[model samples]
Every structure is written in C-alpha cells, then in structure tokens.
Target: MERISKTITAYDKHCDVYNDKFKEFEPYVQKIKEFIELLEPGMKVLDLGCGPGNVSRQLMLSGKEFSIEGIDLSEEMVKLARKNVPSGKFSCRDLRDISFPAESFDAILLSFCIVHLDGTEMADLLKKVAKYLKQERRLYLSFMEGKKDGFEKTSFSEEELFFYYHSLEKVQDILKDNHLSINKLTKQGYLESDGSITTDVFIFASKGN
Candidate 1:
C-alpha cells in the first residue's frame, strides 16, 4: 500500500509533465480507433486510469458523441482530465472502489492502469469490468509485458512506482476466466520518456450476451 500511495503522490506532483508528454502521443491511435468503431454515438464509455483525458480527448476528436466517465487515482490528473475534456465527467477515485450497475457501460478502457495491481487484484478488477460492461461490449487493455513485478523509478520522477507485469498467456487465461473473449491481441514496442524501450501489450475483448 505504501508503494501505491507513493506512486499516486508522484502522479499528483508530476501530472503536468505526464500530460505534456502523453497528451499528443499517438502510438496506439489505431487501436483506439478500432475500439471507437465498435461503438455508436451517444454510447456510455468508462475510462479507468484516464490520465489527462488523452483517450477521452481522442474519442471526442473522432467526432463521435460518446458519454465519457473517466476516473484516475491522482487528483491532479482528474483535474486535468476535466479541464482537457470538459464534455466528459472526471473523478479522482480508486479503481478498486469503482461502483456501477451491472452492464452499465457500453465500452470500457483500462489503459495501462493495471500495471499498478498485483495478480490477485488484476483478477478482481477483471471481474468488476466484466460485470460493469454491457453484453457484446468491448474492453481495451494496455500494459507492459513481462513475468516479474517490482518498483522502479521513471525518468519523470525519482519516486519508485510499483509495476506488475503479466505474460500474454496469463492475461489470456484471466480474461477467459472472467468471461471476456479476446477479439484481438497485439504487442508493440514503446519508447518511454526515460529513453528505454518496453514491450507493450494491447488487448481488445468483448463480453458475450
């Protein structure tokens, strides 16, 4: 818990830098567009760990009228999200505490947020995601690919943030266990601000009606 708190504090302190660095990043824009194509205008969408509203902004820019609800652990990030995507609702909330009715969202994005959660927590989150996502709706997930989990300092901050890495097979099993069928899975290399390269995994899954 201490590590998680420190990570959130780091984000709160460096929200601007984070936003500036990622607000225009477009490595995953194609995947994002694919997710957007699955939804119609006026559909309800939830974005977990929506840093600076980047994904929400992209959705809005796609010219679709999506009802977006975004939540982040950092208060500053939430503030930026609200400012950046005024049409969307933003809140500072823990991912574990997310409460909504079953099948509440037409589409959900868990973008690189599960990196903070351990294996058990990740499984629990998938369960909640499955419950909140409407039938035949899509869920997008992005994360670094690996087998180990630990704390590491990034170029943006000296604070050590806990990162949990899961292999493709593990994530596949978890999603299946939670009743989310994989529609597409892709991996790409990402150049972090620290000048290091990391293999990132992107998954698009859907629930069965």
Candidate 2:
C-alpha cells in the first residue's frame, strides 16, 4: 500500500488542480443538488473525503439549516476547504480512522472517495461508520463499476497504485453483512481525470430505524 499512500500524498500537493479538474463535471453538481433536496433543518451531515469542500459548500449555500462537518485524508485539501468554508467544520483525517462519536450524525456522504480503498479497507470503514451513525442515519457511498484489480495501461497519474472496481453485488454484500439497508442505488456516468467518462455506482444506505 506504499504506492497508494504516496499517490495520495502527491495528490494533496496538487489539491487545487484536483478541485479544478473535478469542478468541470456537471454530474457532481447535480448529485449534490439532489442531496441538498433531501436534507432538513438542524440535520447533522458529514462529507467524508470532502475534497476542497465543494459538496459541503453547495449544501451550506442552499439556505438549509443542516450542520455540516467535512473530513478528508489530505491536510492540503482540508486547508483549501477551510479557506472557502471558514464558518463550517473541517477535519483532516483518514476515512478508515475517523473518530466520530456514536450516533453523532444524521447523514454521511462518501462521494467518489472510497474508490481509493480496497475491499477490506472499504468493509472495515463501513463497519466503523455503522458504529458512529444513529440507527436511522444515512450513509451515502459511490464507487466505480466493472471488475478491476489493477490497471495495465493508464496515463491517469492517480492510477499508479492498487485500486479495485467493484460490482453492485459486491457492494450489496458489504452493506447486507454490515446490517445496513440500501435505501437507493443509482448507476451513472462518472467523469475521469482524463476527461473520459465511465459508469459508476451510488448507494444510499441506512441503519435500520
């Protein structure tokens, strides 16, 4: 996992570029708008792996009363996020090692973030999230579709390390075994760093109320 760690560190160095490149994807904006529509006043929402606070920014600016907290593995990304969203909360930490109090949040959003982790890592993090969430709290996750253990050919700078592309069945197994319920699942186009697009998975699960 050394390569993965190194690539993440390198990404932090170019956080601005990461933000700029992703902003071009209209789908990301559309998803956030949909999320904002689901929220109500005084709800506690967490934006996990929140790169530069883009989604959180949209949520806050939507005139909703939800209390938003953002967390990311990269300190540089957190730094940039804090600059624009000084009034909101931001934490620089790994998703797998997060330290939220039990039943603390009403919702948690993991948008295209867990793709960096492998199967074991994802399962471990999901279990931890289960512990921190309320019985009825929602957990939103996004991942790439198709079967991929590693890539043979790619110019995407972030592709140097191990990454797994998971199927819907695999994600369903993870959620089921962890005692979470899939409230909704959507498959849609995800923009790649190279300006190409590919199908991806989006799931919204909830702890049984």
Query: Local distance difference test, per candidate?
Result: 0.88, 0.76
Task: Give the per-residue lDDT digits (tens) of candidate 1, residues 62-123.
Answer: 88899999999999999999999999999988998888999999999998999998888888
| Candidate 1 stretches greater than 4 Å from native | 193-196
- For every candidate in turn, the CA RMSD to the true structure comes to 1.5, 2.6
The whole-model C-alpha lDDT of candidate 1 against the native structure comes to 0.88
Model 2 has an lDDT value of: 0.76
Alpha-carbon TM-score of each model against the true structure? 0.94, 0.87
Across 32-146, the per-residue lDDT of candidate 2 in tens digits comes to 7776676676788888888888877777778876788998877888998898677679988878787778888888888877777777888888887787778777788888877
Model 1 Cα shift for residue 110 (angstroms): 0.4
- Model 2: which ten-residue window has the lowest total lDDT? 151-160
